[model samples]
Target: MSEKSRDINFLKLFGKNLRSIRESKEMSQEEFSSFCDIDTRQLGRIERGESNSTILTVKKIADKLNLPIKELFEI
Candidate 1:
């Protein structure tokens, strides 16, 4: 696979994992976005892997979820 394709694949997996954890916690996208101080539409894009998130944004999400940053990368 090309480097770009690999990156996209990883992003999708990460997004999927994030969504799974959020759902397990019974948090809706709107609620989670508000708690994380992120825009709801942006969060949706991130969850769909349609947008790349900065490290700080990732940290914010981890902090809001009360999870380690590494957990977001878990498949």
Candidate 2:
């Protein structure tokens, strides 16, 4: 209904999709974060939709997961 709401919804969806993809690969948050060289707490926040991630960070995650960046946003 509002721009802010839309953004929040997008973040939630992205987080959900990311979490699903990560879990599907059978990787724990700690393991994936280690592989991606990202902070585990930050990854947890991203997966919970509690924070917004930079494109660079997203790219790093995609690269580590061997997935296209766009796939992270898929519903």
Candidate 3:
């Protein structure tokens, strides 16, 4: 596979993990965005496996969702 394809696959995994965690918390993307003080569009990108979210972003998301950072790993 090409490097771009590999990156896409990895992003898809991350997105799936993020979506699962968000759904498990019973939160919408909009709500999560609000809680994290981040842009909804950016959150959508993360959900769609388009953007490479940083550790800081992940931590903010976890904090917003009231979930432990460990929960993200289980994905």
Number of the top-ranking candidate, with lDDT as the measure: 1
RMSD of each: 0.7, 0.8, 1.9
Candidate 2's TM-score reads: 0.93
* Candidate 3, residue 56: lDDT: 97
Query: Residue 26 of candidate 2: its Cα lDDT?
Result: 95
Question: Which 10 consecutive positions of candidate 2 have the poorest summed lDDT?
Answer: 65-74
Task: Report lDDT per candidate.
Answer: 0.91, 0.89, 0.84
Higher TM-score: candidate 2 or 3?
2
lDDT of 3 at 49: 92
- Per-residue lDDT over 28-62 for candidate 1, one digit per residue giving the tens place of the 0 to 100 score: 99998998999999989988998899999999999
TM-scores, in order shown?
Answer: 0.95, 0.93, 0.78
lDDT of 2 at 24: 91
Model 3 error, position 39 (Å): 0.8
Is 2 or 3 the stronger prediction by lDDT? 2
Which candidate leads in TM-score? 1
Q: Write the per-residue lDDT of candidate 2 for residues 1-75, one digit (tens) a residue.
A: 999999888888888988898899899999988989999999899988888999999999898878888888878
